[model samples]
Target: MATMNRQHHLRGVLLASVACILWGISGVAASSLFMLNPHITALWLTQVRMISAGMILLVFGQFAGVKPFAIWRQRATALRVVSYGLLGLVPVQLCYFEAVKFGNAPIATIIQYLGPFIISIYFLLFKHVTPTRPEALGMIMAFFGTLLIVTHGHLNSLAISPVVLFWGGLSAIGVATNTLLPRPLLPKFGAVSVTGWGLLVAGICLNVFGPVWQDHVTLTGAELALILVIIILGTVIPFLMFAHALGYILPTTASLLDAFEPLAATVFSVAFLNVQLTNYDLFGGMLIILAVMALSLNGRKMINFLRSFRTE
Candidate 1:
């Protein structure tokens, strides 16, 4: 039993790592689309990604003899799907695009990763559960680490717009909400089905809001190819992998592993974009990695200890 559990945990970690790696590649992929207008690029990429990913998952679900829409008739299930699709998936992507437009990609990535610590706050306020000491310490370290990366190790250099920050924060909240909202429905409908539906709904919403019928739209061969690759490898595959992993791991544990996205992005940028890596970047990256490790390993124990001490 012990060996089985350990194997499961290792598999979950590997799947989560793959998801982060794909997500990291997205940054480098997206940078290539910058020759076109960012808004158009973002809108087109969003549509292609969600639509393609959703369709592929739906097909895969069918092949696996799984009914992806088994719970669509249930009112609660419908509500959960819409809520997750709109408030979680749609807003996170839109807000992230906006953040990248107003700020740097590295900065936006770092800010979005603040989702996990923000989730700890959400549980504390709503669930009336506080984090363990180690978890809290991890969160503190991550917060500073994020700040270090975003400010480029110069706190005085901070000049982000309030609107950008607000949207970025909203994106972070969307991530937290997504992390928590799928638990009950995931078991009933299956993670792949749920994620597929969410992506489909979110894609429709994005189209409704930013209708692609505008005359200014133009797609070059290179852009179209990039968009296709983004849809397949970046969005579809990673999301499926994430859903599969989520089935085997706790939500908080999954979220902690997502902290690797920024680290992966940093590495991707350094390699593909030929971005210079400094000592500060290395230090901040190490802090973020350690913080995630600490949180994943000792979060629950630390929380219990804190609760017991408080009660005593």
Candidate 2:
């Protein structure tokens, strides 16, 4: 049993790592889309992402013997799906776009990473579950590292526009809620089914509110092709991997691993966008990587340490 648990954890970690890698690449992809227009890019990407991911997952759910519509009959399940769609999927993308509009992609990505720390606080205060010492340290390290990256080591330049900061903070909250909301439903309904339904509902919401269809969208062949790639590789595949991994991992663990997305974005930017990598970026990335490693390998020890300190 011990060996089996270890193997399971290893697999989950691998899956989460891959998800972060794909998410990191998405920054590069989104930057490419900026060549067209930011609003159009945001609208189309959200529409394509939600719709394509929804359809793919729905097909998968059906193959797995889960009917997507059947979930709607259960009001609670339907509500949960809607909550995931509206509160989870929509806000993350929208706020991210808004943040990027006011700030650079790297800065926006770093601010959005505030999600894990938000989750940590939520768990610590509301759930009354003190994180272990290692986890607490990891959280602190990750937070500072992300801040350093966002502020570009200057720390004084951290004063972003108010609107951008607000949206970025909201994006973090959205991620925290999304990560926490699925726990109760995962056991009753499979993660795939829940994710599929939520995505479908969210896709519909995006379409309804999105400006792409409103403008009677037309796309260049290149743009259309890129959109399809974003939908398939960027949105659908990553979310499926996420759902699968979430089934085998703790939410906190999953969120901690997600910190790698920004680091991955940094690498992708350096490679494709001609973004310079300074010593600060390297140092910050190393700290975030170490923090994630500590959380993954020694979470329980960290949690215990925090608990003891709190009690003392």
RMSD of each: 4.8, 5.0
Cα lDDT of model 2 by residue, 60-103, tens digit: 88888876667778887778778987888777776776665555
Candidate 2 C-alpha error for residue 225, in Å: 2.4
Clashing pairs in 2: 131-303, 132-302, 132-303, 132-304, 133-302, 133-303, 134-302
Q: Please give each candidate's TM-score.
A: 0.83, 0.80
Native-vs-model 2 lDDT? Answer: 0.70
Off by over 4 Å in 1: 1-12, 36-39, 150-164, 246-259, 276-282, 299-312
Give the per-residue lDDT of model 1 (tens digit) for 68-156: 87868889889988888887787667677566555545556666766766767876886677688888898889877766655666777
TM-score of 1: 0.83
Q: Which stretch of 10 consecutive residues in model 2 shows the poorest summed lDDT?
A: 303-312
Model 2: CA > 4 A from native = 1-14, 100-106, 153-156, 159-164, 207-211, 245-260, 298-312
- Best TM-score among the predictions, by candidate number: 1
